[model samples]
Target: MVWAFHTDEPEFCPQCGDSLETQSTEDGPRPHCANCRTTAYHNSGVMARTAVVDTDRVLLIERGAAGDVGAWATPGGYIDAGEPPREAAVRELEEETGLEAAPEALTPVNVGFLEFDGGESDVAVNYAVLRSETAGTVEAGSDAADARWWTRDALRADLPAEKNNLRAIGMETLLDLLDDRS
Candidate 1:
């Protein structure tokens, strides 16, 4: 899990095209561009995931693209420019599962490092919602190759998998937390 995601900071100044040097600032050491007199700060991308749960079942999606292709995860995607996290959760839920949900219906349940295909630079702000809050039947769409609901036992059967799943080191703990919550 300890990967070099942020180690590839800017090697050269974006404006002056000069080699950048790590200079100490009040904030900490950052890539400093002397010619342009600016600091380059690479920030993590924001992602939103929604756990559409109803008592015993929660909707999950199979990754159709990068990261661990075919791994199951809560329906989610990157937040758009200027979009709120709650709205992004709803949008991602709809895009991946073909089910519509209101932003207000989502309740944030977790916020932590989520490894997308891009590594752990993208942080996940996750939400949980009841199935009754969603509209329409389930079907895979967008970046999801498969989408379906899973019970606790059904979810645990193939878990602790060696993939890009968060907490891949301890899926049993993840299952315990999820079970306790939903």
Candidate 2:
């Protein structure tokens, strides 16, 4: 299925075993296999993140896998096919931090595109809600090494290091949005 392909997917056609060539399309260059006339379209991966807010603090997860290993970011991951973004955010939050958040309690905060070094890319949606709306103790699970609360002041004091040792996109943008909301 189309969902199985990444930005840097195989250069050979899945259907015909023929080498693929790059062809410019409206979206951009895509893999085209002339033998089978198959165009491997790479869809941007859908990801979701949630900030479990406790007054001035928010829950952060230390990634145990992928690009940001050991770096703290809000709880989140790629959304499963057919899952709604809000539900995905809540699911990821629970999966990473052991916190159960109501899907309806999550409010959309921000959305942005992320591209990785190996050509994997994602379009992430961020959500947030007060901690009172969620229930659970903080425990690292899934692909998280550590889970804990972090204050905006602490985060602002030193920008989080993500890919390229830059500020974490989720935290930076979500914090700015929180500032605007307050």
Tens digits of per-residue lDDT for model 2 on 16-80? Answer: 89999998899888888889788887777888888777866777887799767877778888889
Ten contiguous residues with the weakest lDDT in model 2: 160-169
Clashing pairs in 1: none
lDDT of candidate 1 over 39-58, digit per residue (tens): 77766767888887777777
Best by TM-score: 2
Candidate 2 wrong stretches, greater than 4 Å? 1-4, 15-29, 33-37, 118-120, 158-172, 176-182
- List the global CA lDDT of all models: 0.75, 0.76
Evaluate residue 87 in candidate 2 and report its C-alpha lDDT on the 0 to 100 scale. Answer: 89
Best by lDDT: 2
User: How does model 2 score by TM-score?
Assistant: 0.80
List runs of model 1 lying over 4 Å from the truth: 1-7, 12-21, 114-119, 163-182
For candidate 1, give the lDDT of residue 98. 91
What is the TM-score of each predicted model, taking all chains together?
0.76, 0.80
